[model samples]
Target: MARRTGLPAVEVLDACESTNDEALRRARAGAPHGAAVAAVRQTLGRGRRGHVWVSPPGGLYLSVVLRPGVARECLRAVPVAAGLGALDACRALGAKAPRLKWPNDIVVLGPDGVRKLGGILVELCLGQRSAGAAGDAAVCGIGVNLTRPRGDGIRPKAVRDGMPAPLPAAYLDECGAPAAAGDYAAAATLFRDAIVRRVDAWAAGLWKDASAAPLAPVLEEYRSSLLGLGGTVLAVTPEGTVVGQGTFLSVDGTGRAVLALAGGGTLSLAPEQASLRPLAR
Candidate 1:
């Protein structure tokens, strides 16, 4: 009996090229804050780093527009906080507890292995807006596999280079849960509502907190949920250039990954700067 009565009106849609793009368009057109657009499928869904997302029917693909009035320095906290919100939405379905990967991935851990359940993509457009628009707004796009995906090779059956690749499934299977409620549609509704609730909450913090104190709670949650902290990892650039091997430290306040190189020195990596892969312990 999950409710969709949360703030930020959720608009259901049949299809979209990309929810984030559509949401951003609405924002520019003076859409109210928290206005969300969700599609059953996306024709051109993309994740952070512009990785193509294998979006098909039966998954939760959504985006929302918001004006989180935080300073430029504090903007990174908004998406990092979004990781927690997505995690909460998955947990709402009584699925296996998923962990947060630095930057913004929600993944489920199991004896079989870790499978990524979903991701959060946050985009900002500060000054460029139509006349008479709200403060700086961000479009947060979310995608959760609620059932098997179409035959897309991006999400392979096995983890790649020790980093688990994305896969598709209902939240129950997606999170390694053995069983779940019978109603798939109802469950999808609940998950969507849960995610929006978390998003609205985080956006509120960005609007009110000056020093980004609102992210304190999110960072705390991330610590408990973060996957590879204190483990060995190899960093690589988006172009696939190897950065270095290091012990995964923690995500810093600016949403950068802090890596302690094996030989010496520490490096902080932004999402655009690197992707991390776990090394076999």
Candidate 2:
């Protein structure tokens, strides 16, 4: 796909390491931006905080190599753009409504409550360059649930809305979903487009507007998909955890969540290590 777009593409089968790792390796070896690497199965898939990204067959796992010349502080926005991509893909498929919970988790609500639909991980590969150099690159890994496994571990709160959820809505809304074996393919396309647009916008130095522009459309879509936003919730982090009553304000330019705390404090959280769950007040 990247080749057709004038970008490079690479594919691997049964990779022992993660796709992101391989992409990073290639990037360090002078792979240009927009290069993509896909794997059939990853033995060491990873999630936030180095957690294992469980990968079984029937799922989509791939990574994209990007070299965006921006300050390190602004790098956090990649995941936000990724989440938007996923949400757009879901919307295209008929999700109609999908909310991005801070960081990179895609959340959808069913009758039960909020359920995770997919996730993204952005890994920054440090290169041999000066602190102020512009040679650093990042490899973004995306995983989506296509066909639910039979015996995989299931979180009690996790909900699977099935692939049909988006198709019906797509038929009614856009006439048809993008052709693919499952939602994973559709999601990959969405992520790719979002990344391209965001990176191009950033490259053109349209930072402020690009950062704030996505909030409105994303929030509008999130409002309908999110099960809980303005409510008491527990914010879990690696350092510890905090219980607070607040509303999910909006995802900032750096991808940090601007959360309004209950007492009076406003917190900007890097959602990578944080989990938000509703608290019973």
Question: 27-109 in candidate 2: lDDT tens per residue?
Answer: 88878777767665677887677766666664557787777766555565556555566566656566545666555666554
Q: lDDT values of the candidates? A: 0.67, 0.57
Best by lDDT: 1
195 Cα displacement, candidate 1 (Å): 4.0
- Over 4 Å off in model 2, which ranges? 10-12, 128-133, 153-190, 205-229, 278-281
Please give, for residues 1-281, the per-residue lDDT of candidate 1 as tens digits. 33337454467778889989998888878776567788877888888877777677757787767665555556567676666767776676566778776667777766655566777888986764342224677787877766565575334443232233433323445455433234444554555455556656765656566566545546666777888789998887766677889999887656778999988999889877877876667
In candidate 2, what residue range of length 10 has the lowest lDDT sum?
A: 163-172
Query: Against the true structure, candidate 1 has what lDDT?
Result: 0.67
lDDT: worst 10-residue window of model 1: 159-168
Error of 1 at 180 (Å): 7.9
| Residue 237 CA displacement from its true place in model 2, Å | 1.5
Give TM-scores for every candidate, taking all chains together and pairing residue i with residue i.
0.82, 0.74
lDDT of 2: 0.57
